[model samples]
Target: MADNRFEVPEYFKCPLSLEIMDDPVFLCTGSGHSFERNWLQKALDRNPFQDPITNIRYGDRLTFGPNRSLKAAIEDWKQKTNYHSASAQRPPSPPHRIPEPPRRPFGPFTPSLFPQPQFTPPPVLFAPSFFPPREPVAPPRRPRRHFIPCSPNRLPEHLLSRWEWLR
Candidate 1:
């Protein structure tokens, strides 16, 4: 489910309504400059160049116009929020493979536009290996060492000298 709450950027919000502004305008007050154009114009008509919150008076000299940058920021923010909300919904999956319709077997002598379907085994669901298991390889034999006794008489003549140090 998509998240219910989405926060609008403060910069994209109207100073008057405190909501996101679709058509933002700057009211030429040195105080809070951002306002939704139509909403503020109504306020401006009631009282000349006065900001209700900030009563600093510019009289008839107040200058204001569409806030393009703030509007663009609002558009970008809206796109991202909508994209995230859209992603929460599950996407459609590919169509399943439909089983072919059952048909009468063609007589051997019958001429047909479609070739006779060959019988193929239904696909293996559980088998992971495509090829058969290879024969188990026997490990190579290691050369065996002759067991010579520690006794002096049993020692080979060449090994007798080395065993003398042990004596």
Candidate 2:
């Protein structure tokens, strides 16, 4: 058995980096099985491409890397691909970029993306008649106060004196 090291085949090596491949592997229409991502990544990591922004490895197939020119790479790809009707078609529109709020606002804050108020129009406001007048609440009655008199003649003298002294 040969070395099992994660070595890619020579053909798979990216010209820019001349190393083993990394991410997405693109097959160029001009040359089948032209580019490999792992090789591109290794090449890019070791020594960034001269263009930096874009790196077009194979004929029409472009392996995008940081710093390389996107527009140039795309144009090159377009040329190499021969502008095949179906392949040349514009890519699908990306999903809506809904702006999410950093965090829910405490009160009265609305999201800009969705301008309309979330709350539905207060379900047609019903007249006071909608609800029966709360059973008429009777005015709370005031508690009655009464006074008890302690007559000096009715009390025993010592006891009354003690009571008076205690008071």
Clashes of each: 0, 13
Residue 124, candidate 1: C-alpha displacement in angstroms: 99
Determine which window of 10 residues in candidate 2 has minimal summed lDDT. 49-58
TM-score of each: 0.44, 0.18
lDDT of residue 17 for candidate 1: 79
Count steric clashes of candidate 2.
Answer: 13
Model 2: residue 123 alpha-carbon error in angstroms: 99
Give a tens-digit lDDT track for model 2, residues 63-100: 45332243344445445644333323778778989898
Candidate 1 off by > 4 Å: 1-5, 83-167
For all the candidates, what are their Cα RMSDs to the real structure? 21.5, 21.9
What lDDT does candidate 1 reach at residue 54? 78
TM-score, candidate 2, is 0.18
lDDT per residue as tens, model 1, 26-64: 876656578888888888788777775577777475667
lDDT for model 1 comes to 0.75
In model 1, what lDDT does residue 93 have? 77
